[model samples]
Target: MSYVLAKSQNDDIHNAGECGGAVTSIFKYLLDEGLVDGVLAIKPGDDIYDGVPTFITDSDDLIGAAGSYHCAPTMVGNIIQKYLYDKKVAVTVKPCDMRSIDELIKRYKIKKENIYTIGLNCGGTVSPITGRKMIELYYDVDPDDVESEEIDKGQFIIELKDGTEKGVKIHDLEMEGYGRRNNCQRCDVKIPRNANIACGNWGSQDGWTFIEINDEKGQELIDGAKNAGILETKSPADPAVEGRLKVEGIMKKMASKVQSVKYPLVSEMDEWNRCIGCYACRDICPICWCCENCELNKDYFTLEENSSPDPLAFQGVRLSHMSFSCVDCGQCDDVCPMDIPVSLIFDKLQKKYYERTGYVAGVSDDVKPPLYSPEKTEL
Candidate 1:
């Protein structure tokens, strides 16, 4: 067995695209500590999977590990599912990723001993669909042409191999769906609960990071780094981190917004009028469409095969019914070509479900999700 720790330092937070250095550092630390036999993470490459899942046993392989803020890293989830069949694997994920893992653990789809998680504190994530399209439309660049990338101060910087560069400022891309992810807009779990160690931009004064070890495993990794002299722990903030306060302020504002608005759910059945019955939302969801025996896929909603008296009629029902299965990760809304707010249904359901059942779907694996446990039935 070996050690696993998730660490990243990327401005984009899309998929660990920018933090190749930080990811390599952690993998090296784990190798030294002998806590992991292998690490599962995304690495940059020229293959079709430019940002594809990688299993690194040799420390040298980790050099290719990178970071991004892309929201739909479904490959990470698929990798976790696949590897759980064998040895323990350490993985790096953002807050949203952590939540999905928590949900999986509850379903007994993954075992704790077989997995070690490192969570990155997330401010938000970008839709990769939008990212790829923006590059193609604005810069005439393909997703593979860029060697590396980052998003900061409202600018999308793509470093190309031809010594050519492409940059789109946030203002220019504001109407371009740059900051659109259903879960991000309503996310309350800024700090991930499934991680053994959490790292990110939360406590730093400058662009540098302030890593926080949350568990014994995390502590071991950090301590090993200190012993190896790969990293140095500094004193607490002097006047406190400047952006820390700003982040707190913005979260409060978002919380208020969540409270002020009503979420749409399939249970309501009235919110899906805009839906053309295209099933686009279902196809794009990261979680709900996991099964091949999908009832919706068989056109079970229609009176006849491939027939619907009214296509949009089932949209609201579909969303409300699927709310319970939703982690509020927002793939449904992000994928809607019609710009329908499918996530709003999950958001309201999450709030209502949390209030009624006092449960959060993907917080931790320490206990079963409250909805699934009848040992302490409130009813």
Candidate 2:
């Protein structure tokens, strides 16, 4: 991997994007050069807190996708699988997004050659509704008046349209159940190294993005953007690199602590009693693409007349099918009507599987989960 500090050459992108406009500029370069047919990124929804994923075919639309929104918890993996599988696209991905994409690629749901992943270093994300409430309760500001939000140095910071900013300790907000999503709090993958290029503000100077080139494609992206006069780059200083690593280390430690406390054994959970047999978790799971022929749909597993099916039989069947491949993107948790920590058990199972096989789902391309492979015979 190679590390560098980069920024956009476009004045408007540099001024508007988060940290620097490297990401936006890269997308512009890709579109202008015909390297990709489209770009998928999050654009502002009704407000800063409401972010929606948008597909852009025109380079002019890249500006709308500039900046970061911590409240945008949408995943891009499924969108690529379901919509852009045949199209060449560039997308910005968080760790979870990259993980989901990797898992989908493994399942042949997405074509690896058709997509380019620009990875972002993520701390965590807050649901939009919870974010609005947190701004009102903790920041003492009207959620509607807020212009932007960020997570930095253990604080949840928000900037108002009036150019005023406020910050609250993340630990304090989380104690009151107002911080990041539970799965995010427990997520240890801070950097999306599985992508072609990973960019973030952690190690760079002000107004620049620290970029880690993970592969040949990432190097080509940087070189092409620079040659196209859309981006500028320089080597990062030693101190800045060290500081970034320190920040990543601290975030991982926090995640480990959260995981210990939040993920109880599946046998110990009682939230299953509230399940309404909605199957939302199964439907939302990125790895669960066998909806029509799912084992859970079989007559033996179905409750034709009852609203709630046996949790152990229903969720258990899913866990066995693809829990080892679960990326813990938390779509399941987010959609569950019963507010059950559905992803927790899946995440725990993946972790347990990792302990036994040294396999981390979606983190590396070289290793495959044992379930998908067959036994080898020796002569």
Candidate 3:
């Protein structure tokens, strides 16, 4: 592993990117150098809050994807698995997205060699609708006037178009149900170490990005970008490194408190009674790719007259099949029409599985989960 403070040499990129243009420059280098066919990243749609994933094949178009949107919450793993499996692509990933890719790679659903992951350090993401309302209710400012948003030091900050900023305590917002998604609040994986490179502003001075190169591929990406004269780098100072670690520790501690409060035993969740057998949760699950021959579709598992399914048969089936690999990305929770906390049970089970087996899913390359292995030995 290696650490460095880097920034874009290009004036436009340096200004357009969130902290620095390190990630965008790397993608540009990959595209210009013909290392990848395309880049998968988010670009603003109708507004800055409306972030939509875009696939760019041209180096010039990479500028549109610069900067970050905390409201996007789009998942690129399924997109890659479904569409870009055969093509070489560079993509930015949040921790959950990286975890989904790792799980998919292990399942042979995605080709590892064809994809390069540039992981972002994520605090969390707020849903678009909720975020807009949050601005109106809490910040007392028009959400449309906001040009940029950030989560830093326990505050949700927004920069308005008139050169003014507003800040709100994240804890206060969450107390009123206005902060990040429930799964995101409980997420402790702030850094995607499994990616080729992890980049963020945590350990850097202003106008720079702090990067951790996890492998040879990441080192090559950095070196190539610098060689192309689009990026510059320097070693980070000791205090900056310590500050980053301290911030990470605080975030994880917050996550642990949230987990205890949000994730109760599956037995206690009464929202399952509202399920309509729509199968939306399964459809949105990143790991649930069995389309034609899902066990839940079988006669034994499906009651012909009943629209509400047995929780054990439906959610339980999913937990057994993929819970060990669940990254708790919250797609299940997002798509559930009944508003069930679908990820809660799966996340709890995965954590329990980790406790029993000493396995943390999607974080390691050398070990596979015991359920996926042929050996019957207990941990």
Candidate 4:
């Protein structure tokens, strides 16, 4: 409901963090005050490209978790639902991550009161495998030598360990099948308003982060940090606020252009014939939590015919069951052993469902999808 331009007061935090270290400083305040048991965030793994989601219980370790990881696309919501449901935690989430969390909260799978959500505005994310290949093929650099990566002003930029930097137009990289994930390229939810607070560098200058406090918890977070003397805050000027809006609009427009072209279905793609039936797609999905009693496992729908199961029998059944709730996070495609565009069909169905019900999968105000809510049925 309100916006602030903020930066960390700690010199180490400001130097270690992206934008302004506001996010890291806020997490430090939460941990120091015992507000949460831990902060779940992504940190560098083997390298900058390998983003590992870490649960930091100590404020001293929070600085290591700072900065952005565009090539490290990990699903935070599914991890919480499976592992940290009983714990009180604060988490940083992308739009897709928040969407999944929103749906889980609605389903009573995640307790809304137990978690604080810090949403990050994402232009898009790149696959580590694809990113490495793209960097070598286009940027002409060794992917391992790269120290950091960022997407800004339509360019995918990278900094080397020697302090050299390189950039390429994302459109050019994507045009040759090498940029962001397909789902990310078409994602319309650039900012997660459903999160308690959304933070990013979109509208701010070199040393500040633009924060949008969506709820009481978010306001409390800013107030607490500012009062603790770890953070400084002020209202963003008119041009800063408008610039943020303009950037958001441009990102949404790019997504609209991607969506204007129709996405293909699983039935239309022949890649499904290569399915090895490992079921990784189902396992990776944040929304498909019915692993114990999935209908796809029933004898009637069993895939007993080698690796080539009938698409209609395999994906078709899941479509009827959960496609309406697909957040378009693209985990299905990422985990598919057959290289099938599994999320595409699910996203297409969700969009089709949207066309009829005006209910967006993860961002809707509705308590449940129309299919699950009899009173809200469109027909």
Candidate 5:
């Protein structure tokens, strides 16, 4: 995709209002102008423990849109399953989530004409809970001891109230490699080519968000923004944003280097042993799991109700059987109370399945999941 010169900017691209502030403002503007019935974006609340997806209609309801990233792609399916019949909603989603939407439409679950999609350019998102733990373990202090943390100067600075501090490169942290969802590593779709409108750090060189118009509807929205004086045209290259390009490049290279390293199934089993039979992995997976009653909970696997050790040679084998279908979203890893690396086990399995069968999950809506494909095809 070629870059276009648009709004002028000389400020740090990260601080650009459109990429962060303007996109959020536009959500409010749409609500005020009645352009969309409502907008769905991230809303911050008391649940610092877990981020909740919210459906908002009024401009007064928007919160924390600035923190949007590529975390929850499954919410699109949740919306389609629930609201596809009776609503025309504007939803903000990351590049991967938008791809899921495209897949949903092909499944006849959602209609393109009935929805407006705002694509956010991703700078990559980490599981805040996991990242926070990595920090606490590194510093060996109560997490509350951290007054503030800043990522700059090729390192992350952890500030303490005691007027003492330590610095670690963003890469030096263990959670850095674990930051991205596995599906995202195979993804190179930086911009949603199918989106009505797309914005992110990639569109503009300045700290400002680069807005791209992809369709007549998107252009109309841009016209409305321009007419309202909420927008302006600027060159793509702003020195402040350009200066950070090297840093972004370094992070991307590091991620790529890790991607090239081979992780095999033998290593995965060691990781899987950390799983204390907690089925949080199954609950967090966002794929085709259509079961009214899971066998894991039934007498089929359990020895007895509220009973402990197995009476026989077999303990339990449900996780081994079910984990093969996992999509490697890493939500399992993030949600585990025990802090088990279950997603790592699934990631290795997924890699093996992909290598042997050449099947990838959620790549296209039109394509049936590999397991459901014809037996002859597998043969």
Candidate 6:
């Protein structure tokens, strides 16, 4: 509903946080005021590439989750459904993340009033393994020596501890099949406005984050943070606003082109023949909540360990049931031990469903929703 160029007043937060720390400061404010019991966010686990989803119940621990993790491909909705339901929580959401959360809200699994969603503007995410290999192969730098990574100006840039940086064109990396995850490469949703507010470095200058407030809750977060003296705010210049829209527009065009390329169907592919029926994909899907009593577990469909799954009966049943709702998060693709591109399968299904019936995964409209597109200019 509004836009602001915001930064943190605290020097510590400004120095440590990504995009001037506005997001971290807001989380700190929420905790200090006891508005929420905890924060659900991502943090470095084994290293920068290993991002672990964590729940922070104290204000002091919030800063550990401050910076962005482009290499971390995680979904928090399933974590909430399995562990933190009924808790008053604040969480960070990417486009896919918010889409799954939106679906969950529709299902009445999580209450809107109890959760404050901070949407992160996402270009896309790199799988940790793929990222390391890419850096080694393309950047010609040791992946371990890299201290940070960022995607900007169509390049994947990595910074070293010595303060030196190297960049390689994303197109080049992706052309080599080494850049973002397969689902991310074609994902069209770049901003998660379903959250209270979306914050990122997309359109802001060096020391601030560009924010698009989407609702009253987002307004309250900004106003409350500023009133508490932890954050500073100013209206974004017209160019900065336009630049953000332009970036989203370019990304959508690329995604639409990628979407149009037809891949052979699951029935036609030999890849699905390798499925071990491990249920990893099904177990990891954030949208498939009925797994405990899933029909696939029935004796008729069950297969002995190491037996290949029936292409039509196993994956097909699941796809037909939930393909209309797939957000292309790629959690299924990420967990498949057989290395089958499950998300691609679901992506094709989602598009075909839309063609037959004019509804997106979460939206029931005849056309792609404007909220998910970069068509707005006045905001």
| Candidate 5 similarity to native, TM-score | 0.64
lDDT of the candidates, in the order given: 0.59, 0.87, 0.87, 0.87, 0.54, 0.83
Q: What is the TM-score of each candidate against the true structure?
A: 0.71, 0.96, 0.96, 0.95, 0.64, 0.91
Question: Clash totals for all models, in order?
Answer: 24, 0, 0, 0, 10, 1
Please write out the lDDT profile of model 5 over residues 122-187, one tens digit for every residue.
544456565467666666766566644444454556667786887776556634554344444433
Ranking of candidates on TM-score, top first: 3, 2, 4, 6, 1, 5
RMSD of each: 6.0, 2.2, 1.7, 2.0, 6.4, 5.1
Residue-wise C-alpha lDDT for candidate 4, range 272-368, written one tens digit per residue = 5666667788888888887778866666665564443455566666777666788889888998867788777777778888888888978998888
Per residue, candidate 6 scores C-alpha lDDT tens digits across 111-139 of: 77889999998888999998888888998
Superior by lDDT: candidate 3 or candidate 5: 3
Q: Of the candidates numbered 1 and 4, which has the greater lDDT value?
A: 4
Residue 127 displacement (Å), model 4: 0.7
Kindly report which residue stretches of model 6 are placed more than 4 angstroms away from their true locations once superposed. Answer: 262-269, 303-311, 363-379
> Over the full model, what C-alpha lDDT does candidate 2 score relative to the true structure?
0.87
* Tens-digit lDDT track of model 3 for 207-308: 999999999999999999999999999999999989888888999999999988776645524666666678888888778877668878766776566544
The window of 10 residues in a row where model 3 has the poorest summed lDDT is: 264-273
Model 3 accuracy (lDDT, Cα): 0.87
Residue range 1-379, candidate 1, lDDT tens digits: 1122223332232233243234446666676567777888776444322456678877656655655534335435545664544666778877767777766666666676776677776655656666667778888877767655654433557778786777877446645555435456567776664587766555453434445566787776666765775544554363344454465466546645654653423443445555677776765554543546656556656777667525555565565555555666666765677666677666676667767766666763437656556675763
lDDT of 2 by residue, 1-379 (tens): 9999999999999999898899999999999999999999999989998889999999998999999988776579888888888999999999999998998888898988888899999999999999988888887778999888888999988888999899998899999998999888999999999999999999889999999999999999999999999999999999999999999999999999998887664552476667777889888887887777887776777567544458777776777865578887888999998888887878887888777666778895644676665642221
Clashing pairs in 6: 1-213
